[model samples]
Structure formats: structure tokens, C-alpha cells
Target: MAWNTLTCAALARNASRRLHHRALSTHPNPRPYTFHIGASWAGKPNEPHQRPKVPWPADGLIGSWRDRTLARPNRTTTSKDAGEDFFFIQEMRNQSILEGVSFGVADGVGGWVDSGVDPSLFSQALMYHSHRYSRNAWAGEPEIDPTLDYEEREQIEGWEMTPYECLDLAYGGVLREKFVQAGSSTACIISLNASSGLLRSANLGDSGFLIIRSSAVHYRQRAQTHFFNCPKQLTKLPANSGRRFSRACIDSPSEADVFETKLRDGDIVIAYTDGLSDNVFPSEMVTICSLVARAGGTEEEQVQAIADRIVEYARQCMKNKNRVSPFERDAARQGMFFRGGKPDDVTVVVAIVHETS
Candidate 1:
């Protein structure tokens, strides 16, 4: 051992003194600890959990729209169907009646085709009627009313109706034609009110709409699915079916899940069917949109690119030859038929709602 190093006996004595002190201090005069729960409770009595308020833009929102629909590649050669899906948009300028903009998309349920019914017809008719009704109603058409009872309104063709009423008219037509049992459709519609800067949205089935700001999901519709194959939808109902509206359909105005949110400049709104929603995750959508927002070009061009990218992404997912689909994992969890990305009609609508200069 070096002369400067401590001896072995000295090291053992030092270690023993530290251990003795620690043992002497342990458990001496221990007291019970009390925890108060009231101060820590986030939801206190008489006070609901509050949502952080968002500051809305003062300038109005201007929208740029792009959409695409692609048929499933797996359909048999004998089938001529292009996957029943349809949509329309209305963009209005400086006018009171038709001031803002609106758009909607509908996905036809395939079940009707098996019954010899063409779901495309229903989907197209619904979009057509909705577009027409929204045009006239927003243009300050006198005949449409928010207060009119369903029965009191005329069933005639010339009458103007509110957006919800227009949906009812479409439903009644389906019933009168006895196409209710043949098939049904899911729809998601959004109308931006120029004067108030409020976005009004109506949705059915798994089809949904989402609003993104700064590439973050600000708002989204709830997907209504009873099970994997069964989703809430607008379907055939009795004429006198006093049932009116359900969460999925509007018959007599029972009720509608109308989503209202204030949109600011640079916010993006996307409405899509299960083809895209089920296959692609929201985080992926945000990533694509973020790139679109930063890509060099005019805002219009960027917006168009965003829509194209979204549709292309969904299409690629459908045709992905390798890799297990995220959708399959979901289906398995839900006890759905095991498979890959659902091969069905794909529809996507993207609107860049921003401030008008």
C-alpha cells in the first residue's frame, strides 16, 4: 500500500460510522400523511370542465375546393358500377342570397345493388336536390322556412325548401319510389355562412368532415358505426313514419347533428367517405396538408395539390400489394371480416377556407 493511501482498518471504521447514523434516523417519530382531494379535483362543484377558447379571425373565410372519386379496382369485370359516390359545391360572390360557399359528398351503399337497385341514382339525386335547394335557400329564397312543419310543406316540385327540408324531400322521393329497401347512402355536407362566419355541417354514416388549422385537427365529425359493416345511414322509411329525423337520417326533422364552428383564415376543411377515412390515419392527412401549405406556388395550386395528394394516398393504400393494412387491424378488433384495405369507392373533398382580401 502507498504511504499516502488510507489503511484498510481506517476505511472499515468510516463506513461503519455512516451506516450507524442512517439506521438511527430511520422511522423516528413518524407521522401519518394526509392528502386533500378537493384542491386537486379539476372538475369542482358547480364548475364544468372548461374548454380553452380559440380566437377566431375577424376577416371572412374564402374557400378553394377540389375533389376526386375513384372506383374500386377489385370490382368484377361484369360489373359496370364505378362505385356509387357523388358530390357538388356552390361558390357565391358578392350576393346576399347566395353569399358564401357550400359543398357535400354522398357514398352509395352497395347492399342495394344486390337487390337490383341502383344506389348511384339515389346518391346523384340527393346531391342534385341538395345543391339546388342550398342555392335557392342561400339566395334568400322566400318559400323556404326554418319554422315550417314537415306536413304543412307542399310535396310539389316547384317549392323551395331549407337544406334539411331538401334532405327530407329526397328521402320521401326514395320512399315513394320504393327504393328504400333497395339501398341507402351516407352524406356529409358543410355550408359556410358568409355573414356570420359560422360553418354548419350535417353528416351521416361513417362519412365525415374535419377542420384543420395550423396543420392541427381543430374539429372532426364522429363516425357513426353500429358495427364494422353496419354504419348509420339515411334509409327507407314510411311516409307517415312520425319518426322524423334520427342521427343518421332526416325524415320529419326528428333531429340533426349539426356541427357549428367558427373558421378563420388559412383553415382547411376536408369531407370524405370511408374509402379514405378508414384507410388513412388523421396524422398522415395532417402531414400531407402541412406539406401542401408550405409548398411553393399560389394558394390555389397548393390547395389543388393537397386534394390530389389525399386522393392519391387513399388510392395507393387500397392497392398496396405488401404490408399489413392498418384497417385490417381495426377490422379484427371490431370483429369484422378479416381483409386488407377496404376496396370500395373513394371520394375526397378538400376546401381551403381563408380570409378574403
Candidate 2:
């Protein structure tokens, strides 16, 4: 049951059918507000690197915020060969200042192959198309007609597509042509409108997003691995679908799923690629975030500290394997193994919400 043997046609058929059903559901329009965003990226050991910068809105915020990415990393590496391919983009409506959205993405390296497609491309595509898609969806654009079903258009309720759908269409086309090697990614995006205060989110693969309130944590997870012969149900693309068309598909490519929630004052939203999650625990993440908020520094400094703690903690744990406290060792063995075992590409984006009086 190697990843090379999975069938892409069957997987695609299933995914497309699932998406057809999801599109039929009703989605709530969201309220919106202005907010600040900051992001950062650190490539895996010995690989190319790119850093995410603060994106500023094109126009003044009436009910929205914006930010843009800086540039790709200048330094290159060849060791473990794990580098981060990440992207982020923010946009505001052309006519309306009260409506806007933001998207963030990080592509995971395909197993051993270079997966011809750069990770940065995927993130950039998500950021670019998501804004476009959100604009269209909010404006009531028609979904891609799978079969040009004119009959259904009259009798059936059209599905409200998410930004992820636009991303899939755009990204899928690019990967089909450019990326010859097998690869996968975990992505998450958030769209908000100040007029309605509605927040929409979508995810795929393993990248994660977290909402932090005063005392609680709400996490949204996407993209589960389709390991060799594993039976867990995660979205996996069918085999032989991408450029190579020879490698087996593991997990079905996840759907362009969406979730809506309300935003309140004093809320903190954190989005990150697997590089950060794989090496750090959820509780530990919360602790680091709380400390950063209290200590009060630039977003970049806070982000660097969080990334450093993960790398340093993992490195230290690897060094003191035998000295683990009896109680802690057992838990560490089961849970922290991935974090301490090796260094992986790490990227984190932190946004702190301020209540406008």
C-alpha cells in the first residue's frame, strides 16, 4: 500500500462528488471589522527559505485590513533539504472599504522528490485567488458548472463556494503543468467583512488555525497524512494525478471546506504550517502566545521568539533523551517525538485583535 499505488481517478471522483454536495448548502454572510496582521516563515534545515512580511491595506480601513508578503529567502541550503514554501496575501474590495479578506498558506515538501512545484507558489496562489474568489462569492458569482446543468440551476439551490475552491481550481491547473514530482500542502484562509462582522475560514491538508480567547482555545485542523498502508480517513488525492502521473496518491485531496464564526474584542487568531505544529504541542503554543502578548514587543520579535523556543526545545529534548524525567519521558516519547527527532521547516503567523471603541 505504498503511496504510489493509490488510484487518483477514484479519489478525484469521490472528492468531486463530495464537493458537489457541499456546494449545495447555505452559507451565512459575515460581519466585518478592521484588524492588523503579521506573519513569519523559517525554512526547514538546509533548504530554500522565504519570509512573510506585514501586509498593509491599499486604502484606509472602513471595515477591513490588508497586508502583503515581502520576498523569498536569499540564502539556500542543501542539508536535510527541508525548506519552507509559503505565501500570504491581503486584499480590500475595489469599491467598498468596509469589505476585505486575508489568506495564508504553506506547502509541505512532497516525500523525497522535489515535487517540481515550489511551496511558495501554492501559498501565493492561495492568497491571490482567495481574494478574488471571496469577492466573487460575496457578489454571487456562479460556481464552475461541472456539467452546465441549466435544469438544476432553476430547480436546485446553487452552492456557495469558498475561497479554497478558487484556490483549488487555480492551483490544480498550475500543478498539473509545472510540478512533476509528488507533493502536498496544508492551507488555511480567513475572510472578514466589517459591515456584517462575519468571518469565514477554509482549510486543507495539515496546516492549522487557532482562535484564542481569554481562557479558551478553538482549533481548526486540515490535511491529515495518507501514510503508507494507514487506515485513518484523511483527504488524499488519488494516485497518478499530478505531473508525474506515476506516484500513488496517499490521502484524498481535501475539499474546499468552509467554517464561519463571530469575532469579538480581545481575540487572538494564530495560523501556522505543520512545521510549527509538528514540533510544538498545543498547550505549549498557548503558553508561548500568552507570554508574547504580556511581554509586549514587535510582532516580528514575538514570532521569532516562538519559533526559537520550538527549535531550541526540540534540540534540547533530543540531547537529553536519557535524562527525561520518568513521568515526562513516557509522554514525551509518545507525543514530542516528532518535535525533537529532527528539524523541519517552520512558519507561524500571529494576529492580535483590538476592540475598537
Candidate 3:
């Protein structure tokens, strides 16, 4: 993979033209802000949602969290008990130095189970490699650039990597991992620069993030898909696998849609897998955020509550077949009929931004 998009010199040139700065940079910031992150998750069947003991803070650039104790199906995606979604929230760094934060959600393609592949394996590995790459900006092991294309002295830690670049490197990492076998996943990634107040994002499929401000949904990315219920995804095929898998909505991280926006104080960023969107409407999320934004402890605590409410509400919506859901609405638009909410692995990451005191 040509990760040249984030080379040191190239990034420096781009930085000169952008409004945001890496939080770890020594440059003077005219306006400083901090980000507080919170997240929630639940597998299929709408069990009680779970979250980290506490929300993540603006303290460091390398803090990361993953869920392992939750019970999920061991194999087939058709299993009602399966949870094929995965997610991560980690501070992005440049050579161990705090720069920004990167977070994302990945939903494994359940159909892979038909080919004897575990659906969770691909989604989990994708998040793992992406988090590792964002934490240190190196694909594989600690300091070594697994690509081994460049000389040691000039290896790139990605001075200010873009969301797509991060996805690209992580995609490379998955290819390097020999045990992955075969699978595919839809991903949406975000990079927030605190000092510059800029949000850079890359989305490859149904999983996406939304920007909520002033008690309303401000900006939302439309999902990319080949057709109704078939989202764009990145896949790794086995050596023997042929064109049979090629017809799937296979995509490359390079093709991810990218966007940039300047953030403001008290903005809410919600990133989630399709499960949330499929069940809960955008208007509903804005109402949830507005109601929960206040009556909070600290910044992170507030967002955590918001995250919890959104996921729990989505689960509730899933169990109700009486009302029309986002998924059903979308299917109707495509001339396909569907019932209530979709039941799949749900993962969410929420962030609240505040100006420095």
C-alpha cells in the first residue's frame, strides 16, 4: 500500500493550509479545546447494553478500549446470538507523542459465515490494526514499519495522518496478518484535532458518524452501498477464493469518502455501526442528545450517558415491530419492503467538545 498521503513533508505542507493543528504540536494555538469520549456496545438479541467503567479523557494520546467479556456467537453469522461488530477509541500519536484522537466502528459481513469464516474475526482484527496504527502510526510491531519500503531513519510515523491514510495502513496490516483467512467489514473512522478544532473523517460503508450541534443534527454522511442492505466493505480473500467473492461490494480504504469540518464548543459527535441508525432515527438522536447534554457530572460523563441512552433506545426500537425504522424506510425507498428495526451488533462512540477554561 502506498501510504505516501501522510508522509512527514507532505503533511507539513498540508498543515500550512489547514486551520487545525495536532494537539501535541508545540505551535501556539489561538483557540484551545478538549475532547471527552464515551462509548457503548451490545450484541444481537438486545441484551442490556454495556460500556467502559468510565468515559475516556483528554489526558493522553494513546488510551484505547476494547470489549472482550461480552458473550457472542462462536461462528456463524446467522446465529441469533452472534455479535459481529467491533469498535475502538484511541488517541492518535506521532512517534509516541500525542497529536489527536482516532475512533471508529466496524461491522463484519455476516454472510461470510456461509464460507466457514468467523464474522467477528475480520471486524475485530480491522479495529485492532487500525487502533495500533493510529496509536503509534506504525502498522505492525512497535517501531518497525512493516512495509519495510523506506529506510530506517526516514520511516514515517505520519506527521498528521488523514482518516483514509489510517484506514489504508490498517488495511495493509490486515493483509499482513496471515491468520485472518477471509472476511469483510464496513468501517467509518474519524480524526479530531483539538487545537485546530477540525474534524477529519473517512467512511467506507453503512457505519458512520454524525455531528450534532445546537440540539439538532448538523452534519451527517450518507451511507455508501451497492444496493439496499448491501453496504460497501473492505475484504480479504483466501488464496483459493476466486471471483465468487469479487462480486460482493468489495471496496478499498482509498475509496473512502473524506470530509473536513471546523468544530465548535459543545458539539456532539456520534459514531456508530448500522445497528444504531437502522433502529433509531436522526431526529430521535438529536432529541436524545439535547435531553442528556445537561444534568451531567463531567464532560466525559455526560457523553457516556448520551451514548448509553442512544444504544439502549436503539435496542428498544429493535424490539418494536409496530413502527417504521430507518432500515425499513430505506428499503421502501429502494422498492424493497422490510419490517421493523434491524437486529445486529451495535457499537457507538460519542465525543463532547469544549473550549479550554
Estimated TM-score for each candidate: 0.65, 0.59, 0.78
lDDT for each residue of candidate 1 in 148-205, tens digit (9 for 90 to 100): 6544444323344334555655556555553233447877777665544567777777
Q: Pull out the clashing pairs in model 3.
A: 20-196
The candidate scoring highest on lDDT is 3
Candidate 1: segments with Cα more than 4 A from true spot? 1-82, 92-98, 139-166, 173-181, 237-256, 321-326, 336-339
Model 1 residue pairs with clashes: 62-354, 97-138, 97-139, 244-252, 245-254
Model 2, runs deviating above 4 Å = 1-32, 46-68, 72-82, 94-98, 112-161, 173-183, 227-247, 250-257, 297-341
> lDDT (CA) for every model shown?
0.53, 0.45, 0.70
Q: What is the lDDT of residue 335 in candidate 1?
A: 78
Candidate 2 structure quality by residue, lDDT tens digits, 1-357: 111112222222222101000111122433234444544455555334442232222463210221224332211222222254454545434243324445565554444244333444334433444454444333122355677442242233333344555455435533543322333455676655444445666666666677777746865554444442121212223345555445543333345456777777656667776655555566666665665555555443444444334333433333343543322433365564322233456555555554443
lDDT of 3 at 6: 31
**Candidate 3 TM-score to native:** 0.78
The CA lDDT at 218 in model 2 is 68
